[model samples]
Target: MSSTTRILLGLALGAAAGLILAWFDPAHAARAVQFAQPIGRLWLNALQMTVVPLVLALVIIGVSAANDAAASGRTARRALVVFALLLSAGAAFAAIVAPLALSLLPRDPALIDSLRDAIPAQAAPAAVGFADWFTAIIPTNAIAAAAQSAMLPLVVFALFFGFALTRIDATRRERMVEFFQAIADTMIVIVQWVLWAAPLGVFALVLAVCASAGASVLSALGWYIALLCAMYLAVTLLLYPVAVVFGGTRLRRFAAAILPAQVVAASTQSSLASLPAMVESARDRLGQPRAVAALVLPMAVSLFRITSPMQYIGAASFVAWIYGIEVPAAQLAAAAALAVVVSLGSVGLPGQVSFMATTMPVTAAMGLPVAPLGLLLAVDTIPDVFATVGNVSADLTASSVVARAEGSSEPAAPA
Candidate 1:
């Protein structure tokens, strides 16, 4: 069968499986939904398998390659400038969207109880202040941090290694680059082979989410969905487009260039899983410079699940409001700051929501109930589409800005 045919089959089977299980026994439906978990898990594991090696490879390659693209100092400065602008824009966007989502939904006393009941027992402790934030970033041990998959520390370590690789003599650096490139190439091959199963994996992931959620979850949270739609529109239509324009890209061309990454990201509900494709799409189809696409896209996945953080900000504020806690001006500003900082550690992996959960210091500080996290669990997949789209858009925008300013001789593939 053609790829499109296989995708159709997966979608059809997933939908039928979900509905059949729901009709026969809603409780059993959840069991059926479990089928998707392993597929999704395997897919995520494959992506993560390459994280350390790929980051090491790309950053080393990026720094080494930067020397050839332009003056090393200028290239580094320009990339940082683009990255910083994107980060600031993302934080501002979250701050604006949070207040809007809160204003649209009235507080429900019952929701707090229902949400509390739905929460798993091993809930994260409420974060209190700067100390709690500082403690979260400090891993007990470096090896343990890498072993336990602590993202913030892993990034810290990788950046140090990448920078070190750049300081080596050219011949030695080139040899090191060749070795790491082989590893990256091997990982890329594995990533592509696994991607053949992507449509099925995506269907399984989405179907499981729909089947497992209570029938009333959607109906009861109608206003929340409206808020989500508003958030999506603002991000998709306004914030991302403005970023693209500011970065010297035309709207129509930018959309065309980024659509594939958006589609894969939307369907997979993961920016990390979507990374290999995003890299290829941006390089081959979007005509982004190789160094720009390779460097910015991966970094963007780690730093930008744009819509998810926005959702969390909304949830944080709503939880505070419903529980009769006034989020002080200082606290709100702090949350805004933390949201941006925490995003640097957000890999586009399955536990991303959990990472956002960890980022909620302001909510915890204000004595807000974390129960509203349950409400977010229901709609996570839905809003992921927008988040992933924003992620890809930011990468492309950064790529364009960097390319233009650097006058990198590479032209992205024609849209």
Candidate 2:
């Protein structure tokens, strides 16, 4: 079976087992949870250890790639800016909307407590006032921030460090890129290794959580999935307005042209696989020149994935809700920034890898516990499809915007 399938099967089996214990024998449920928690913790730790380095490495590599793309021409530079703005807006939207959505859900204080009791959660760090928090964003020392798991500051530092790499000699930059790429690859290997045990880990975790938290746990997750679906759909639909107003494409024609690419994205669950269709839609249906489509579409596929930031903010907000922590506006804004940075850095990773690698930084930036992430990841299969659809649609939307900006500056056909 596919790894996702196996992990989900494990989740189902564990939840079933736990529910039986909760209903039938409390004493056995207690023992079973004590036995299982450590195994799950170990798996989570393995995954957690990789996050900092992997993010740093990927951010550096992504910066290098984006630098190369921007150097290609004015069109590439404009497109990158558009990608950043749209991603930031989507993330900011999620940051506000997800918490609002979570608040409207039925709150069972007892259920929340039981879920917390299911696995011991780390206490959130003491809050700092705005002055301290704002200054900390620059990180007085990067290594110390990372060692302390001060993700927001460290991520900020990494962004600066990545940009600095661009000013060095080209040969030196190439070497540094190779080095960080190796780090990223190594981290991916470790992630894959850890995930191989995901079935067992998910089983242990779900069993313990379901036993204490009761079947009400599923209701919360159901709500989260539903929220994510609605958010992704909303983002996808919003792109239509963006393309029309900024890209200057007709609404009906843009809709018709993008349909084929959106179908390909939905079916394949891959923007890369949908590229040819997106190019065709851009050139033939939208009347974008072949040259414009060729440049913008490919670059969008490589270095941009709009939904990545949205998912990060959404996950962080959901976790904040589960723990009953009220994230301050400054912290939520910081989480939004972290979400955008990580999305840009880790843009093109596989859904599973990106979920783990990118989302954790945003959650950590918000000072939320990471314990619940594995269960959430197990259930991500449903939302990931829509995330891909939104991403591809955003890609086409971005290309149209770039084409509008570049109007009549180039030939109608590829040189």
Q: Considering every candidate listed, which one attains the maximal TM-score?
A: 2
Stretches > 4 Å off in candidate 2: 125-128, 409-415
Least accurate stretch of 10 residues (summed lDDT) in model 1? 115-124
Model 1, residue 410: C-alpha shift (Å): 2.9
Predicted candidate 1 versus true structure: per-residue lDDT over 1-415, tens digit per residue: 7544554566556556665677889778766666666665555455455544544344445444444433535655576567656666655676666665565566655544433333212233344475655565545576775565454444455556556877779788778878876775665566556546756664564456446543333344455556666766576666456646565667776677677877887787666778888787767765667877776666556544555456556667655544435565445555665454444433433443242234333344334544344334334444556666666666666666766676663566553
In candidate 1, which residue pairs get closer than 3 Å at backbone N, Cα or C atoms, i.e. clash?
A: 287-412, 287-413, 288-412
TM-score of 2: 0.97
Best by lDDT: 2
TM-score of every model versus the real structure: 0.54, 0.97
Q: Which stretches of candidate 1 lie above 4 Å from their native place?
A: 1-77, 108-222, 284-286, 352-359, 412-415
Residue-wise lDDT of candidate 2 within 311-382, one digit each (tens)?
888887888887788887888888998888788877667667879998888888888888888889899888
Clashes of each: 3, 0
